[model samples]
Target chain A: MNVVVLNEVRKGFYLDSVALMRLSREVAGSPGVIEAALMMGTPSNAAIMRNAGLLEEGTAVKGNDLVIAVKAESESAAREALDNAIKSLDKPKTQGEAQAAWRPHSIAAAVTARPEINLALISVPGEFAAAEARKALNRGLHVLMFSDNVSLEDELSLKQQARAAGLLMMGPDCGTAVIGGAPLAFANKLTRGRIGIIGASGTGTQEISCLISEAGAGISHAIGVGGRDLKKDIGGITTLMAIDAFDADPETDHVVLISKPPHPDVAKSVLERIGRSRKSYTVCFIGASEVQLPANARFSPTLKGAAELALGHKQIGADFDANAVASRLPRSGRGGIEGLFAGGTLCAEAQVILAAAGRKVASNAAIPGVPKLGVEPSAGRDRLIDLGDDEYTRGRPHPMIDPSVRDDALRAALKNRDLSVILLDLVLGYGAHADPAEHLAKIAADRGQDAPVLVASVVGTEQDPQGRSAQIRKLEQAGFIVAPSNAQACELAVAIVQNAGR
Target chain B: MTDQDRPQYQQLLARKVEVVNVGLEGFVKDLRDCDIGVVHVDWKPSAGGDPQMAALLAKLGV
Candidate 1:
């Protein structure tokens, strides 16, 4: 039944007028909400209603300053929703509450009477994510956090509280997660498959998710154990809990672990835990290449490597073929990779790969090598640009998702006559909405025969998919060479560039 | 990248260049004083708005 609860509406707080309009539009668009009104001010205040677009052509009220409305659903459901929304409202704070901008999307689970929801995937910004997480945990929900930039101390406290309550708390800077066959913010919706994911890196999760989807397998659940979750103080608490959850889940078959290299002690603890479980696991702790894992745990250098291992079939009679990876190798390119990525750790992994390949960086510390292995600042030099550094990426989408920087990066590559090869990475799957190759293909077309060899690696799956292969095929059709893996793409790009020079 | 250096970021602030902060009449006077190309601020929501204040900054051409 549709019932409106008017328990807690305070006046004078801004409802993000633009966001409110969008919410009203979504409501109006929905067949469920028969009618909606935006309530404002008390009876003693200035105006009964100021600028509510949700109001009918001529609806007016005299007594209570309530945003009265009817529902498209049975009155009981609508009324209950209104009641819940009102109850959630706090006295309009002087500066506005954190959740003010986001309209609460009522998932069917919110109304269900189940005491045990498998997961709560959250993506609100870092400032308020802890509170949201605490609220979810208090309600006995296991969390898949996607917020970044949260303080480490807060994450620790939240994890401790959640542990006390026997609930799982996933991320402070968590980026990617999948629950109940749905992709959360920054997730790849792939074709359904049996592989499961447990990651501490959002981008790492994104990379592996895309890779598996591309390999024709899909994730059952991709849990994010936020970056700091594996540290000594935090102690990999959430990762352990997620492992247990996936181990018990009937849907999950294989498990993939993706994260930045952890401390030795923490790594030891994680490896030990994995050894106890029967589920086969693929681990990609980027940069800690030489760590010895037990026989059951396979190690990969990159996120894609972990995914490739997870999606490949087990053979009846085969020597563990280390070099027989079925997926495309990173395209080889000429010139050292001018890595312009957002995350420090991803940049670190790229640099590690470049170093292992004997490539010299030409620029900055982050892109470090003898020849700099990165972009350097020069007076009046405009063409060879450097992004992915902290200076350029603030307040905007990361370099992977934002096409403007990618376009600019490509333009810089094109302008540099010395640049015989363009090395780029394509991150797909959830969290990002733009088609990755949409712009690169244009740049490739513009070059025609002269186009610098454009090589990239896409990370995602069909179940939580980002359509990277289609993007690669499009680039290939446009005459640009495409590689299957980041390593292969880098190798091919370097070769092409070297050949061009010769 | 420290907060202390924020005050030194005049170029960035200039690039962010809002017309209302520059003042409508004074800006127009300065433009006319210089005899440069004129610039107008149409502060209507349908055109370009800063709705919270409901103050429309307009530049009328003859």
Candidate 2:
């Protein structure tokens, strides 16, 4: 077999990471291509290309330059793949071409064109995100920053400026929000109602909002505070602001706060502020032990519990019968649970549930009270993996955006006879993968009969671009027991594991 | 002054959301699909993504 490596660097050319990733995926799927990557020549990206063996030593590439690298079975294949990548990047879609003539080149230009624009969604590369966000804030627009890898100092500074100006700075790495019935990046289309969500975790916000919407209740707004807002440095600036916004908005009669365990001092101050609010609050700090809550607030240990308390009852019903489903499975002696999740918060929620059940849960993105999945394996220990964690998504798109990231892991877990059950989550929204369930269903269909029982849940609405019911139907048809919600998915997986060998 | 009058963010909840999408065109398409008002910004790294150059340009008020 002939092997060849080739690359082309286009000076002063640029595309956003998502477009580049899409282009790279297209090129990689070309005949005989082993691997392909289209990235800007930033130091970090260049390093990624180098580590992937796509770049030669001492290759001259600058940050503004576009790098297209392909390794293929032959020189002809490599050349063809690179040409196709370049062509794909150059070819403009019909709508984009029509709008290209009038699209603004900067935030200032955009604001000038639409002066009524009160919100700026910043999704540039992390190095350049803060600058764009600063410009947006200066223009008196609230910001939803969808880019990650931004420095801590920049986030702190940006949030402070937005606070002083009384504007909302949603994130430097914020991924989800639904403001005034408008679904922002990576959010479900939810009905407008009384519950307002202030979440530090992206998927936590989505799960709560989707559950609320599914319960016939609705969301006034689901504001993302990034992942680190409740840390000691940021001190819940956006969270506090979102709480205030909900408190003042007459449309919102209740508020739900969701996050991993926050910095103790920040949590205290945040709770104190929620205490002053006239509206009732449900605080779901996953994995956080019981603390003194404000009189107006109730504490929930899971995302479903948060929605339940906010709705004033248990409105979300069970999607499947766990005991009956477990009884149908083979009673294997092997008993280990493996959870592969696209949502980090879903993974954390699973870990919290498993930990509370006296099971030692290890994860790459472990919340408080759970141990990290170390390099050395612990025998018989349950593992929940957040494929959306930075380690899994360094150069590739997020698992929610590109479901292929979870494929190899899911396959391995399914084939592992040591596992009694495999837990999974399919997140659906505007920015998520078009049909993640189809991708997983195809893989699950290939698993042997003796393979572990597959239990899963979906965090989305029926109104999402990828319909939730359709995704669940696909999974269920492919031999998966689909739970209604993420928390129930974990419980169902536990039931299956415990029922094994009984 | 009441708490409602203290923050400008609260006022945002009462108004319609008109968005200026910077960096990603996909987000623009998503917002438009939902019948929300949005404009796209064809964003590129200023000063060719060089940190020093970008900082210099910022200092020069570019």
Candidate 3:
């Protein structure tokens, strides 16, 4: 392959991470281009390119410099792709760009320019998220923090100040929120009905909303409280506030709260608030079972169950006949399952299911009774891994939107001859990978039938931008068995393992 | 909520939601395409995309 690496091209143009990510994709899609990455020359970025064998001798790059790298079928193709890469850097503007109002260089300038503006949506690097979020909260603007990797201490302080100011601080890692029917950050294009969702998990919210829509109901709003809101430290501040908002809004009829298993005290406080709401609501805390529900609160252990309960129907979890998969197993030590998931909640759900089936399943993050996967154990284990966790996405886009890293990791994991099942979750919605199923399906097609049975769930509605049935059909064509929901998919995988032992 | 203890954000729910997009212009475009009017908050940190940029934005806010 012909490789082209350009150092220090754009001096101070200041392209944010999203712009850089799109630029990389555009260049990679160009004719004859095998691979390309256009980004600021940070150490992590440099390390990424170096791993791909792009960095060269005497190539001195710094964070402020624009580093362009490309590999192509020929030197000429590399040159042409490099030209397109540089052109992408000078991104053009639309006709109305000149007529647009000036951007205020500071939050004060912004608030002064538009007094009606009440929310500041911050998407910067993880380390910088707190400072920007704090500024917005201090200025009386509710903050929607899209950046992750923020310290929990900063989150607590920010939420504390926001509470003091009577403002909402949505997340340091919030995924989806639709306030007044405005979808933001990885949310589905949902309808404006009377049901509002307060969720900590991104895909969990999408699954619930999509199901609600399918059941002939719509959504009023879906507020993301960030993943850690129900933890003991943050104390479910956003969860209670969102419940209060839904409780007060006359437009809202029913409410659904979606989250992973939370700390007991935090869950109790949140439950008490929900118990007090005049209107009844549904709580779907995945992996958090054996909880007593209040008279006004409905409890669901799965996302699909929550949606079904919210619609006044009981959709029971069905049993899957994965015995055929078990019979094909090699009956050797390599018969473990490797679940590489993009959604942490989905990963946690699978981990819980596998553990309940009397198996050891490790994870990179804390998974209730499951032990934390040590540095090396996390590499290869009978584990359900969250590839979108901070460990895998420090300087990269989330695996939900960018499948490059996850694709590579999964391909490598599939090489394990002992792996009996390769489990995955394909989430289709706004800001998610346009066609996530296509990549994994290709990988599944490459692996032999005896290698690993690829089982997956498509977390979306038929109305999703990426057609849900169409995406599932692609996976099915590529020799994959697709399930209706993530929870069901986990059950199928567990049965595959148990049947193998039989 | 009690008038004395009602949250400050409580009033915002009743009003029309207007957004100020910071750092990423594409989001502003996305919102506008959705027919949701958005205002531009021109914020460029001193170090652009680095950790130090956060402190710079805060200083600018003050």
Candidate 4:
């Protein structure tokens, strides 16, 4: 009989034991059976063994506790294993359960059996992700985690485990990435080149990964450290590890770090860590630029600039001047600036910039929710809100994910008599659900002749060259002025309002 | 063995109902009831036919 071991398949959350035991007994007493043992640690695993009838007769082990063995030859045995495992099992556990597992093949085995598989991506749910991750690490495979909603506790623990094992865990909710010049889920494959990326934003990572590749640089890996890894308690655990890995990799030369604003303390720690590294670094923390850069680190006003600066270094007509972009920006009239963003970090950084300029912005607003836009006499406040915020978005794609939200807001902003200026973040890359250009075109088409909509975008070429170019072309064709950095967009928006008031 | 004369022969005949059967370790007793045929199918949506069903159908040459 040929024996096959199915690896990494796991019981979802809320596993049951009774049904499995009955199934186990059926398998054990089957004709032509040689021997089989159901191997598992969870309680429900035992039930499967008992039903297969491998349990010693008169043994005290209950169905859930029974561990049984059975033997059969060929594909029959393998099928029996799968059948006996899921018998009488009811509904799936919470979506958080790990419903999948992976089999580890040795390096030589992998090379021989799956030579074409240059990448290994993982998408098991959060609960059992760590164990499967461990198996991937043991096999020396690069892992891309698509599961989100993981606890910070599990994230830190798993990251530490991954680091020790010497593997990459791309995300807890890593929505997009490109590897070895190949498109993975939500990735746009482009020409490969120099800048390798480590980003907190999955879309941001996809954009930068594609940009670097488009700029004639190949990515060694685009590691996504999930949004929460840079928080105070987590302290950039995965980000730092990914950075070091990128630094050592011969395939990567430039590294870009993108995230929404983290806690001040965590930001400082991240800056310190980046400062210690010898590699050239470009950073775009969405809200505040709290941490001063080390000699090798450079800060950008937007993720777009960071990608360009990291990949092309100094390109002509590409404004690398930070203050220039800031100066070019239109100020929020003495009123408040209304900044509606889909990405969290973009909001965080915008608030920091506003506060530093002696302006106050509401973070998570509660009541009387007319979002502030222009400057006011009391204080120059900036309102940073997510179009994808729970109050506004759910079940629906976040504004950044889809452009229809932008058009709706554009119409609303144009109609508001009290509104000074409108601000938006347009993200483009692989895995992004909508095109920024088409969205901008809709905004341009919908705008009242008198209202000027200020547009800012974090877009680039590597992930989806055709899509990126198409979005840019569409926006340009619409006569809507586009800015590269979020700060620049804010400044431009404010300038338009301030100039109008004068 | 004629159906009339074979209770002992039926026991011997029943054992021949299956070909090779393999499962996890220790659950051999489940096979005691060889009266019914057991088939296994993968959980994937693409898996349409059970191994036993297919094998049985093939024997019928349908």
Q: What is the DockQ of each candidate?
A: 0.01, 0.68, 0.50, 0.01
Q: What lDDT tens digits, residue by residue, belong to model 3 across residues A74-113?
A: 7787788888777766667776976686777777678887
Residue A175, candidate 3: how far off, in angstroms? 0.8
Best by lDDT: 2
Q: A1-502 in candidate 4: lDDT tens per residue? A: 3643332233322221222334444554555455554433222334444554544455443211223345455456645654655452344556543442222222224434544332334443233444444444445445556554456765676666656655556666665554444344445555655566777876666555555565565665566777777878677877877666565555666778888766778878888888887678888765444458888888875554676678656442255443444355444333445666765555555565555455456655311222343333324345566665544532123455455655666676656545555666666544354466676666567666555445555545533533665665677687555565555565555555555556
CAPRI-style grade of the A/B interface in model 4: incorrect
| Model 1 alpha-carbon miss at residue A418, Å | 3.6
Docking class of 1: incorrect
Model 4, position A308, has a per-residue lDDT of 64
Off by over 4 Å in 2: A92-96, A99-101, A375-377, B1-6, B55-61
* Winning candidate number (DockQ): 2
Ranking by TM-score: 2, 3, 1, 4
lDDT of 2 by residue, B1-62 (tens): 66456667988888889999887677877888888999888777788778557644543447
Measured with C-alpha atoms, the lDDT of residue A96 in candidate 2 is 60
Residue ranges of candidate 1 with Cα displaced over 4 Å: A1-119, A312-336, A342-349, A362-393, A442-451, A461-466, A477-479, A498-502, B1-62
Worst lDDT 10-window in candidate 1 chain A: A314-323
Q: How accurate is candidate 1 locally (lDDT)?
A: 0.52
Of candidate 3 chain A, the 10-residue stretch with the lowest lDDT total is A316-325
Evaluated at residue A162, the lDDT of candidate 2 is: 93
- TM-score, each model? 0.60, 0.96, 0.84, 0.56
